[model samples]
Target: MKATTLITVLLGTGSLLGLAGCADPVPEEPVPAPIPSVTPAPMPPKTPLQASHALFDETNLRTSNTVPTGGAAFLAGLEAAGFAADTLETTTDLTSVGLKAPSIQFAALVDSTCLIGQYGPGDTGYRSVIVAPLVTGGCLVGESHR
Candidate 1:
């Protein structure tokens, strides 16, 4: 409202606006570069030998103490793991005298190899072997239950 005071305020405001343009620029932080995307390589298929052992272990034959050793569950496990039913040979769960056998022998014929496996009542564990097919065009010998 006072003439001299008003002029002084205007000069101060104008001087600040003029100095603002001459001020130093603010610094900016540097940004990191983006990472490149990667595609993983596909895994190779498991060999028949590996598959046979995997099937045996996956079915829990190593620790199975009951009839599953020579029972349908064991065979079903093999079949479910891509072993054809026709390619499997197994021994009878019961002996000739109608008793549980000490152990059961089974085989899964894959390609030209037969993965022979055995599991008993107290099998510490069972490991399958990769062997050639029998002369009879099957994996097992003597009388097999299929």
Candidate 2:
């Protein structure tokens, strides 16, 4: 080929090569808005009650109890009070006791008051199991339902 023709071809190829090296121009996505920091609310204080206070009652005890009705939060408080993590059991049969221990079987009332369990059968009705502070935890000793 002629010198001029060859020079033109080389210039065209160089220009094409230079264009290929350039980055693609694309509009970037907008950055997402930053999430607001969350400050968790302080936990409420837990009140440990008597073992009898933890029993199952039909009326007053039920009102003051915090176990069955308080849901998981209440159970958590029990654990905080030293109840074992593996000991908690949920129930549906209302007549079928709610919570128990080796020495005590009881039902919750409202917040942390009423507890109804077995001392025996007849005349020996309700029994109270002592539950110390969340520090001492709950010590259960007795025969539970099979």
Candidate 3:
């Protein structure tokens, strides 16, 4: 081989070996620990009044009134919340029944005990049979007994 060619071949080999020697031993990075899948706690069940609030948009029955507006506001609230308005059956005597949707029966009796209105010892001006939402199942459709 020619001298120049021989030198060129040696130089090429030297350059290749020099580049190979420059290779770094790749350091393995530490893998981050996997985060555990955290499930959130379920919400607690709502009470009758709370459930009513959630289902209805408004309540006409004033808990403090001696004679609530025949629970009109309360019934309206129930409809707003999501219950079927017609499914709720009510009477002035506080004996009301509702077809609790999805499979549940609801009955509520509004009497002196279930009265939403308040009264003083001598005050009898507002003695109404108010129809209020059932404390347990669904909407409330009621009327005034007075």
lDDT assessment of candidate 1 = 0.74
Q: What 10-residue stretch in candidate 3 is worst by lDDT?
A: 100-109
lDDT: the better of candidates 1 and 2: 1
- For each candidate, give its TM-score against the true structure: 0.57, 0.22, 0.26
Q: What is the C-alpha lDDT of each candidate?
A: 0.74, 0.42, 0.42
Model 1 regions lying over 4 Å from their true place: 1-48, 60-68
Give the TM-score comparing model 3 with the true structure, all chains together. 0.26
Show model 3 residue runs off by greater than 4 Å: 27-30, 34-146
Q: Rank all candidate structures by their TM-score, best first, as comma-separated numbers.
A: 1, 3, 2
**Candidate 3 lDDT over residue span 12-98, tens digit each:** 999999999999978899899999999999998986655543323223223223344334434444355455555433334233464
Over 4 Å off, model 2: 1-27, 50-112, 117-146
Candidate 1 vs candidate 2, TM-score winner: 1
Candidate 1 to native Cα RMSD, angstroms: 10.3
Question: Residue-wise lDDT of candidate 1 within 1-146, one digit each (tens)?
Answer: 59999999999999999999899988788788898898888888997668666776666463354444555656776777677898878878888899887877788787778878877654445655778897888988777866
What's the CA error at residue 80 for candidate 1, in Å? 1.8
- Residue by residue across 1-146, what tens digits does model 2's lDDT show? 69999999999999999998895878799899999999999886545443324322333233224434322433444445555445442222223365432223433333323232333333544344333323323222332221
